[model samples]
Target: MPTSILRIDASSRSCGSFSRDIGDVVERSLLAKHPGADITRRDLAQQQIEHIRNETIIGYYTPGEAMTDELKAVTLTSDEIIAEAKSADILLITTPMYNFSIPSALKAWIDQLVRIGRTFDYDGHSFTGLLPGKQAYVVIAYGAGGYSDDGPLAGADFAKPYLSFLLGFLGIQDVTFVPVEATTADPATVACEVEKARQNVRSSLDAG
Candidate 1:
C-alpha cells in the first residue's frame, strides 16, 4: 500500500467526462488499499496549465541557484508538479484521447515533469532516469480503437504507447492502463467498457 498518491485528470469535459468519473474510482480504489493515504490532485480540465515554451526550456537548463527571477517564475509550476509526483508512491492519471493522443494539457505536464537533469540525466553517452520505484495507472478514454494491442487501427492509437514510453523514461516501470474505449459508441458499449475499466482497477488493487 502506498503512503501518498498523486491523482491527475486531463479530460476536457468536466460535466460529461467519463474519464474523470473512472479516475475517481481509481483514486478511491487506491485509497481503500492504503487508507488515509495523502492524495494530491491536479485537475487539468479545470485549471489552466500552459504548454511548454521556449522560456521554460531555457529555464530548465539554468541552475536553480543561478536562475534569474524570470526563469524561476516560468518554471515554478513545472517544478511544483514534478515535486508532487516525486513525493507520491503511486500516480493515478486519466486522460481522454484527443485526436488519437493525450490531451494537450497532459502533454504539457509531462514536458515539465520530465526534466533533463532533474528527473533524468544524460551522461555523455547514455541517459538515465532518476525517479524510480514509483507506480502509475493511466485511464484512457478513447473514441475508437487503441484499446487492445491486437485491435484494429492500433497504429492510430497513440495514447498508450506514448504514455508508456514517457513514464518508462521517467523510471516508472510498473504502469497500468485501464482503458474505457468507445465512449462515442452506443450506451451499452460504453457501459460495458466502463465496467471493464472498473474491474481492471479492482484487479490491480487485489494484485497489489
Candidate 2:
C-alpha cells in the first residue's frame, strides 16, 4: 500500500547538517520503493516552535475564551500537530545531536504533540499510549565518537534514548535508528560513515 511519510528536519544548521543529508538519502530510497508515496517536509529551522510555559499549560486545561491570546498561541497547536501525525503512516525524524540531546525546538514540538488524553493517557493506575499503527525512523548525527545504548556514554547521551522513549510512549513500537556517528572525526572517516548510513537506508528500503 502507498504510504505517507512525514519528514521532520530538526537541524538548526544550514545544508551542512549531515543528519538531514542522510535523511534525504533515506527518503529517496523510500520513494523508490513506494513510488506513490507522499512526503511532507517540515524544516524546524525555518519555522521555530515556541517553548511550553505555565500559561500554556493553564490554557490547555481551560476553556477557549478563558485562555489569553498569548497562551492560546502557545498551547493550542496540539490539534494541528496531532492531526498531521495521525495522518502519516511513517515518520522520519532527522536531527543532529546538540549537546548530547535533541534540539530545543524539536523538544517543543514533542511537547505539543504529546497532549494528555490525546497521544497518550494516564489512568489512575498507569499510562497508555493511544497512538498506534505508526512507524518511525530516526536519523541521528553526532560530532563526537560513537555512543550506543550500551557504553560509558550511554546514560549521558540523551539523543537516541530520548527519541526511542518518545516514540515508544506514542505506541510506535516499530521504530528504527540510523546513527551517523563521528561527524567530527577525520574528513575521510565522516565521509565513510555517511556512505555506510546511506547504504543501510538503501538496504532497509529494499527489504521493505
Candidate 3:
C-alpha cells in the first residue's frame, strides 16, 4: 500500500508564505520517496476551522448510544478531523509563529483532534494515545531570528516546544522540525533562510 500523508497548512498568507514554500519542499521530497503516496492537504486559513463549543464538549462526554442528534451534529467536524488524522501515516504541518505560538486555527484543529475515547484514553490513572506508529514533520517559520535552541531568544519560542509536546501526546514520538527563521531580514537573508529550510527538509527525509 502507498504511504498516507496529511499536510496541514496554518499560515494565513495565501501566497509568498515562507512556511507554505517550505511545505512544498517537504511534499516534493516525500513524493520522491513514495511516488504514489496519498496526500491530503488541509488549509486551515481557507477552511477556517471553528473553535470548539459547548455542544462539542457535551458530545465528547456523552456515550455514543446516548448521544442526541443535536450533539452529533455539532461534533461532526471533530469526528471528521479525527478520522483524517487516524488515516494518515505521516503528518506534515507548516505554520508561521503567531505571537510566539501556533496560530489560533491550528490550535482549534488540535483541540478537535485530542478527544477522549477517540485519539486518546485515560484509565483513571494513566493516559494512552490511540494514534501511534505515526511520524510528523513540522515546518515553523519565524519572522525574526534568535528562536532556535542555540539562539539568544530561544527561551521565547513557545511554538516548537508546544508542538513537540502535543504530537507526543497524540502518540507521534518521531517528530522532526524544519525551521525558517529571520524571514523579516534582508532579501538575501530571507532567500538564504528559505534555501536552508529546503535543505533541512531534504536532509531530514533522507535520514528518515
Candidate models: Cα lDDT each:
0.87, 0.84, 0.93
Look at candidate 3 and tell me the lDDT of residue 46.
96
Please write out the lDDT profile of model 2 over residues 19-102, one tens digit for every residue: 989898888877887789988877889988677778767766777667677876766676678777888999999998999899
Per-model TM values vs. the true structure: 0.94, 0.90, 0.97
lDDT of 3 at 56: 92
Weakest lDDT window of 10 consecutive positions for candidate 2: 145-154
Writing each residue's lDDT as its tens digit, candidate 3 over 5-92 gives: 9999999998989999999989899899888999998999999898999999999999999999999999999999999999999999
Better of 1 and 3 by TM-score: 3
Error at 193, model 3, angstroms = 1.1
Residue-by-residue lDDT tens digits, candidate 1, 68-93: 99999999988999899889999999
**What TM-score would you give candidate 3 relative to the actual structure?**
0.97
Best by TM-score: 3
Ranked by TM-score from best down, the candidates are 3, 1, 2
Off by over 4 Å in 1: none
Off by over 4 Å in 3: none
lDDT of 2 at 66: 77
